[model samples]
Target: MAEFTVNPLRFDPYKNFKFRLKWDGRYVAGISKVSALKRTTQVVKFREGGDPTISRKSPGLNDYDALVLERGVTHDLAFEAWAAKVWQIGVAPGSEISLADFRKDVILDFFNEAGQLAISYKIYRAWVSEYQVLPDLDANANAVAIQHIKLENEGWERDTSVNEPTEPSFNSTSA
Candidate 1:
């Protein structure tokens, strides 16, 4: 069976440049970069008592890598707010951390070249583990100030509900 039923003619894979991150029911602005989603499972090896030479392997715990989101420095307080939930420097005794609503589920949406929604993935229980307010300043170098946040997520799965969209074609006639 063909993988892309809607766009069967598409031979090239989707590009990584067009993507958006959404949380708190709204899209996050200035998300320039996002780390790859990766997961690994530990392999458990065991040897039978009778068959000493042979070893069997089984799947163990699964570990999901932390996701890093980067964007140009702006006045937005979304990143700072989320990071503060995990740990804050100044606050009353133990009220620094927002334990009640720290973790959040974020949606990553990938768009096609025509700005159509192509795919999406739902990150489960993601919480900010690290936050970078500003990048190193250089007097001679010309670059945008980038801020980033590292999110520790329990797991993530592709949003199967978002299927391959029917690509649009524009027809132009000569004047």
Candidate 2:
């Protein structure tokens, strides 16, 4: 135990809004939300002298669920184009759709209050799995239409080498 110094407490929970979403190192659009990964495990049992009461916890596979992103639809056709290529919709009959056309690495960045890079999760080999357009048109409600897109990735790795880097901004509407 050293002398009592000022304890730099960095314990405040980060706000959910200060996050940015990027696809292939470029900010495709303003994203509203990104889902988290769900981890699961399997148990193995062994036969004992009396009964099979002893069990061992084995390292199970990491389940990367569909990451959902909510953003406002823009005039750009990138999303539509990606969707078309992903599902092989309206493509040339003889043309071959390779993995490069659909899969892209995504980066989800979380920032601190001082507008600095706090954490980043690099999602590997991601592709747009699903897209939905649920627009609720109303005259009284002045709300921006939010489009949702679901992406499935192979895995994600956290990057921690950044410090006080420029914070990327997403759409204003945050949950």
Candidate 3:
């Protein structure tokens, strides 16, 4: 097991709203939501002939869940460009997909209340599996047009190098 440094000053957990996503060495604009990072391991069961009543279970393959990123529809082509790399329409046969650059590593950075970087996660070999250009349009409803992308990643790990930040202190003296 890995060791982690605890923050004594912090009693409350970090908020979910303070996070940013980055890919291709640059931050994507206006990413308002990101799904949780989850992984599951397959269990292998085996039992001896003598002990047929009891089954021994062991860990097998690891499966990483796909991450969904959501944001309001805008002119930013970052999401569209990456999604197109997986599959593009109206291109010459065999050249429609960008095989070399389709997969990308992304970083998810979490910030503290003071806008300081507190923690980060690195997602490996992620590629866009699903892309929604726009959500259901409703004239009567007042809501932002949201677009989303589902990224299939091989795996993800927390970046331990990003240590807990020290909370700032504000001291005032009467003049």
Candidate 1 C-alpha lDDT tens digits along 1-175: 3254477778889999999999999999999999999999999999989997889999999999999999999998999989999889878888879989999999999999989999999999999988999999999989999999999999999887787888888999999
Against the true structure, candidate 1 reaches a TM-score of 0.95
Give candidate 1 regions above 4 Å deviation: 1-5
Among all candidates shown, the one with the greatest lDDT: 3
Instruction: Please state the error at residue 7 of candidate 2 in Å.
Output: 9.3
- lDDT string for model 2 (1-175, tens) is 2232222456466777888888755776777777775544545445556766665455655677778888787775656666665666556775535556688888888888876777788888878878776567788998888777888888887775544344445678768
lDDT of each: 0.93, 0.71, 0.95
Error of 3 at 129 (Å): 0.5
| Count of steric clashes across candidates, in order | 0, 0, 0
> What's the best-to-worst order under lDDT?
3, 1, 2
As for TM-score, the candidate ahead, 2 or 3, is: 3
**What is the C-alpha lDDT profile of model 3 across 1-175, one tens digit per residue?**
6667778989998888899999988899999999999999999999999996999999999999999999999999999999999999999999888999999999999999889899999999999999999999999999999999999999999998888998888999999
For residue 49, model 2's alpha carbon misses the true position, in angstroms, by 7.0
